[model samples]
Target: MARRYDPDRRTRIIDAALRVIVADGIAGLSHRSVAAEADVPLGSTTYHFGSLDELLTAALRRSNENFAQALRDSEVCAGDADGGEGASSGARLADELTRVLGEWFAGERGAIELEYELYLAALRRPALRPVAAEWTTSAVELLSTRTDPATARALVALMDGVCLQVLLTGSAFDAEYTREMLTRVVDGCA
Candidate 1:
């Protein structure tokens, strides 16, 4: 006979795993600790996830979903700006990118740190790199439609640099500063 499973309990375990990762880093993740944090029996963890890798995979998927949603939302805002409905005309597109980058950098350091852990894992675990690479590709493709491909790549790089700067220094780079830099870059390319 098959064992019974509690879907809600399973979700709680995964969420707890994420919290543990955020609080203690992925290196510290373990069934006993996660079970303690989730307030579930340790057996429930083994029953729900069978293995640590399985749990991490699920967590990574959840993280990717959140990133995907953010990218889509950013793209929608960019679309509105493209259609001239947002406040800044064509400039609105760049401004939206700046805002998205700022919010992602300043507000979501846990996610960023989680992402760095994922990156280190990807280096050692080949299966994980594509998930992140695909996310980067989608974001770049969205930006490239408004700006040239090369410039779009540069824009993404600048955003990443600004994010790292913020994460390291606790400084908020002004969104307009990026907007102004992109304006000059895009204008010069025209």
Candidate 2:
């Protein structure tokens, strides 16, 4: 019989792999574990992904897709706060931007933890480098729409740092507190 592609099975395995990665981190992922978690035959793991590195690459790509979509959704929801035509004036946009940034930092930490695992994996595998680089560039471009390139990059770094702080400290990194600091850095460039 000719080989057939089973998209659903592949997706199921990938989803299970993500859960495993989230719970145990990347180093703990294995085809056997993923198969058991996916409730598929061990052979099914090899059938879908030729090797462990390939499976991890797919999982990281999936993480990239999921995180990008989450940010897009957050942007849409936050945009609704912009009153109407003249709704978001100068200071308003800045405030709304900070609020949006806070919401993202609060809500997206889990995804970042997954990303942290993916990044560590990427360090060992060159094949995954493109995915990591593309994710970073795409994220920067998304931020650039709201601020200049330099400020956007800075904001990305700040968000990453603040999210890490919150994750490590188990406390909220209030955007309001960072607003003046970020605004000063952003406005300083002009």
Per-residue C-alpha lDDT of model 2 across residues 51-157, encoded as one tens digit per residue: 98889888888888755565566552243354646543334445555676666666757766787678657888987888887777776677666667787677667
- Best-fitting candidate, scored by TM-score: 2
- Residue-wise C-alpha lDDT for candidate 1, range 1-190, written one tens digit per residue: 9966666998899899989999998788999989999999999999888888778777776776765577677653245433546455336666667766667766667887786576557677666677667657776787777766776677667666666666678676677778776655545544
Model 2: lDDT of residue 179: 70
Q: What is the TM-score of candidate 1?
A: 0.73
| Candidate 1 wrong stretches, greater than 4 Å | 1-5, 48-50, 75-90, 105-108, 144-151, 184-190
Window of ten residues with lowest summed lDDT in model 1: 75-84
Q: Rate residue 37 of model 2 by lDDT.
A: 94
Model 2 accuracy (lDDT, Cα): 0.72
In order, candidate lDDTs are 0.72, 0.72
Error of 2 at 13 (Å): 1.1
